[model samples]
Target: MTDIARIRLLTTVEHSLDAGQQVVSLANDEDPLTLKDRVGSIERIELHFPHFTDGRAYSQAYLLRRRLDFKGDLRATGDVLIDQLIQMERTGFSSAVLKEGVDPTDAERQFERFPAFYQSDVVNETPVLRRNTPES
Candidate 1:
């Protein structure tokens, strides 16, 4: 399993998703852009929550996966905690970028905090087929 790592920096939303450009995005609080729009062209999105208490990025990540079906890389940066790491994965983030000055090795151990599966209410049963007697 190859751990996803940050390779580049994207300063603007438009620039990040543009077909002509591929840059890692870091969103700020005042960006005023929805996660749906941001992920449309983004190759990878990094949510920047200035504080742990700030929950906007959580919602953003959720929308990216649940609503937009974003399959590319997703990461959380800034003010991340052990408590939030599992929720981050549940919300559809593929990776987490430890805050500055933190050791990246420690994060690999954080995976134990979250359960592996999310049960859903929707169900589909396999259809059964019965053969009818041949007409004589």
Candidate 2:
């Protein structure tokens, strides 16, 4: 398993994050590739989910990490749930501000239950089975 930092569960959005780092927030529909030019100057990007059923933000995170090469923090905000934490991290979200009333401790367990994945994800491009296999 790739050593992903523990997913943070913020009760509220911290407007001023990380000691003056430039933070940008994007609506679910916004295209992350459009920020390619500004990626280097940004320290964090928050992608809103709006509703648990709305998954556009996942695509946004993937584009930011794999296409834009955004190395800084990628945060998921709004409608965040314990069910989404694992996929969020796999898709490049470093943290999340979960929806109101969701227990942080319960959310944390989602990672423990499934520590490793067989499929490729943004953090690990190589499938688990192919990772150590000799080239055909």
Candidate 3:
């Protein structure tokens, strides 16, 4: 037998978060512009890709990484596929939650599909030839 000794009260804070430590979820409809003010302190941003065809998440990821300059973890959840893995990494998703039954090994193998890229992207910020070529 157990007796209830004490109960603690749970209170909610009504203040603006200081150096926000919260992981904010931005939906496809929710513009990342709203987070501009608090982007710096955001530890992580989870961009929900409701379906594979919805490519808005790609733009959101790029905006967050390139425009906002967010260096935190950008995770993709929902409808993640092995075929889109490379694009996800290029756009700036540091981690992803792939759909069920998709082999992790296969998804990882997709990254190696292209050994090198000619243009710059979030993954390879510099063009390969430009960096490798010596000054004339």
- Name the best candidate (by TM-score): 2
Clashing pairs in 3: none
Q: Rank the candidates by TM-score, best first.
A: 2, 3, 1
| Residue lDDT tens for model 1, 39-72 | 6677767778789999888777766665676767
Per-model TM-score, in order, reads 0.57, 0.88, 0.80
Off by over 4 Å in 3: 1-21
What is every candidate's alpha-carbon RMSD to the true fold? 10.2, 2.4, 13.8
RMSD of 3: 13.8
Model 2, 38-131: lDDT tens digits are 9999988999988999999999998988888888888898888899999999998998887778777888889899867899998788888898
- What clash count goes with each model? 1, 0, 0
Higher-TM-score candidate among 1 and 2? 2
lDDT per residue (tens digit) for residues 1-136 in model 3:
0111111111112112222366888998888878899988988787888989998989999898888888777777778777887787778887777677776677777766887778777877778788777889
- The residue pairs in collision within model 1 are 17-41
Candidate 3 lDDT (Cα, 0 to 1) = 0.72
